[model samples]
Target: MATPNTAATPTFMVFATLRDDTDFAEFAALREDEQKQLEVLRSQGRIGAHYVSPARRATFVEVVAADEAEVAETLATLPFARFFDAEVYPTTPPDPAEIAHRARA
Candidate 1:
């Protein structure tokens, strides 16, 4: 029998800097690859990922994990990990509902 995936208390944010020469079409393809990877991570308790684009020289990627180890493994597995300037940070994110709740408080 397999153990069910567990959720981590605090997630993580991973940042990736795209190569200077990266173009839109290329990153778009890369994004598809990333989505595939996320499916694997999701099975292992990954919360989600966030991606950002800058006018030039880098892209930022964020991955929310159940714990540090989960984040580390996910980062290592990313096809683009070695291609970009990458860093992982520990984080606690507010749920969207919580954010809405806070806005009203």
Candidate 2:
């Protein structure tokens, strides 16, 4: 089960799948705007890594917010918001020390 987000646990992973009926032409038209908005979020530290798979029509974003609602709000700012069906999962970033230990093991 996913843990609830709190002040100390504000990171979230969002998986957004593109709707089947989404118009690709329209999405292409707004690509520039989407890129700009994503840049703004990154600059503000509201978003971290963003990965997209055009073949799978999916996007994964790392978000920093107070809760799921805030995460949703942040995503809604995207030009492609209407075209996505998103699932938000609260996350705790992996510990670097733990990763190093596991790697050495």
Candidate 3:
């Protein structure tokens, strides 16, 4: 049986950057395939918002997952996974009580 995961599950921001030596043609082809996969993941509620850097060299993708491992797994499915450096940052909602306390201070 699999061990239960008791840790907090959270959303994440995924940062991915193409390698400097990446082949443009190959990258374009892989990127097109990756986009199709992303659409499917989005429909499944695994992926959320997405953005591109102003220079269009890097991408930021939001993912809803159980942990960093899940985020990594999701990224590994991307066609460019082997050709890019990626990082995942977990996120949490701010406490409303804290916000109210700060407002009263």
Candidate 4:
């Protein structure tokens, strides 16, 4: 499987919560389409990981893009996107040296 080269571009963590007024039936109806689009993004190396918390009605996705606007543009393609209140956060891997120092402290 192809993966995004995180060294070449920025990575973002998108946290999207389903609006309280969202219709569960409508969300379910659009699930298949949403999955298809997600698969496409994954194949294109635009997405790294996708996780959901059904109990909390929230989703967390790792996105690879140049900026937050690009991340939003990528997510906007999802069928259920209109129902989401999304926040995009820039992310970086933890520094290994810091981790080692902390471990020894």
The most accurate candidate by TM-score is 4
Candidates 1 and 3 compared: the better one by TM-score is 3
lDDT of 4 at 28: 92
Put down candidate 3 lDDT per residue, 1-105, tens digits, no spaces. Answer: 111212333568898887889898887777779889889777665676788884867889977677788888877777877877888888774256533533443
Q: Give one clash count per candidate, in the order shown.
A: 2, 0, 0, 0
| CA lDDT of every candidate | 0.59, 0.79, 0.71, 0.80
Q: Model 2: per-residue lDDT, tens digit, 1-105?
A: 222222444688899999999999999999999999999887666776799998999999988787788888889899989999999998875467533533443
CA lDDT of 1 in candidate 3? 17
Ranking by TM-score: 4, 2, 3, 1
Question: 1-105, model 1: which lDDT tens digit per residue?
Answer: 112232324556666677666566766778778778767765554435455676655555555555667666667786666557767787666677644643443
lDDT of 4 by residue, 41-83 (tens): 8777677789999999999998878888888888888898899
- Which wins on TM-score, candidate 1 or candidate 2? 2
Better of 2 and 3 by lDDT: 2
Lowest-lDDT window of 10 residues in candidate 3?
Answer: 1-10
Candidate 3 local lDDT, residue 65 = 78
How does residue 32 of candidate 4 score in lDDT?
95
Query: Positional deviation of 80 in candidate 1, in angstroms?
Result: 1.2
